[model samples]
Target: MTNQVQIWTVIAGLGIGTLFIRYSFLGLLGNRELPEWFLRHLRYVGVAILPGLIAPLILWPEATGGSPDASRILATIAAITIGVWKRSVVGTVVAGFGVLYAVQYFTG
Candidate 1:
């Protein structure tokens, strides 16, 4: 198959899979409250996944061609600190980018 065909097929499959996953929960749990244990665990999903997704980038950024850099690592640390302190996603992202750029500029 052509690359475009393969890409489209994957996209379609992912869309259908997402639809089923969403529908399964809504349909199965209609008008029912989720168990407290499950709900509590679900609350950590974002926290857990966000760090997992970000840690690799901070440790070995693609922009640095997989090399570990002080600027990115410090920026990530600052961003996490600001985020936890302020509880603001926008502030955290802005701080992270700002620090990353500043560090790159000054060091280079």
Candidate 2:
């Protein structure tokens, strides 16, 4: 795999990116206290990111190529089903992945 990119570089990049990303929030917050206005608005971060969280599922489902297949669709439906039926986030994710993998095995 001489022509292939170095695995270390890819890992290093992932590490740097992860560090920078996590640092952006934790580092800034840990350095000093943020203003109350910023704190007041912090609650909205979840609301603001809500669309960012769901947009890919509906619009760019194919972006990830494999994970977003029909199994994922069924898994998402399963997640919603768990949320409605059990109202548990942990249960939803677990059940969703299970549903996805099970259906993927059957289909593939």
Candidate 3:
């Protein structure tokens, strides 16, 4: 078990580190206009980040003890199919969740 002093020290260190990391971006570059190329590339940050964030949950869900679950896999497929066929974000999400719940309901 960690002592109170050590725990507070670590917490304070992390707070300071997070502050600096955020300040380095907002404080330093907040005034300057970013280049067009950088801005253009930044548009895809969401495209990259969404998959990076969601892939692990679908592929190795903690609910399944780090193994892939069929319901989630089928949901992903349904979502992809809806995304490709309808090209609608809302439709894709609805399809994914709808399939996920339906599969889990039937399977479980």
Candidate 4:
């Protein structure tokens, strides 16, 4: 069907675009030491990206039909607390998921 073909075309285009974006930096910076200023800024990339990716999901979750849910809010708080206290990615994820399931179990 034409719709299926269009979907596949879009998927392929996205895959290629993501690949090129990832490879561009590696290829362009091969065997080169980045400047200290650039390296310092790069350290904040994850810090910036994590909050950007999470804020929307916490504030307007798709599962809740874009509504703010208590479970998600509490879980996000717990995750942030654990992340700040323990400074561990795995710990933060575990705490978030655990709190989410616990809240869902009790509330639902």
1 versus 2: better lDDT goes to: 1
Arrange candidates, best lDDT first: 3, 4, 1, 2
- Cα lDDT tens digits, model 2, 27-99, are 8878898899999999899979977987587445765663556666778788889988998989988998899
Residue ranges of candidate 3 with Cα displaced over 4 Å: 85-87
What lDDT score goes with residue 55 in model 4? 92
Better of 1 and 2 by TM-score: 1
TM-scores of the candidates are 0.75, 0.52, 0.79, 0.77
- TM-score of the candidate numbered 1? 0.75
Worst 10 residues of 3 by lDDT: 44-53
Least accurate stretch of 10 residues (summed lDDT) in model 2?
58-67
How well does candidate 3 match the true structure in TM-score terms?
A: 0.79
- Per-residue lDDT over 1-108 for candidate 3, one digit per residue giving the tens place of the 0 to 100 score: 999999999999999999999999999999999999999999999998999999999999999999998999999999999999999999999999999999999998
**What is the alpha-carbon RMSD of candidate 2 to the true structure?**
5.6
Model 1: residues >4 Å from true position, as ranges? 1-14
**Candidate that scores best on TM-score:** 3
Clashing pairs in 4: none
Q: How would you encode candidate 1's per-residue C-alpha lDDT over 14-101 as one tens digit per residue? A: 9999989998988878779989999999999998898789888988789889999999988988898999999999999999999999
Identify the candidate with maximal lDDT.
3
Which clashing pairs does model 2 show?
A: none
What is candidate 4's lDDT per residue for 20-64, written digit by digit as tens? Answer: 997888877877999999999999999899788989999999999
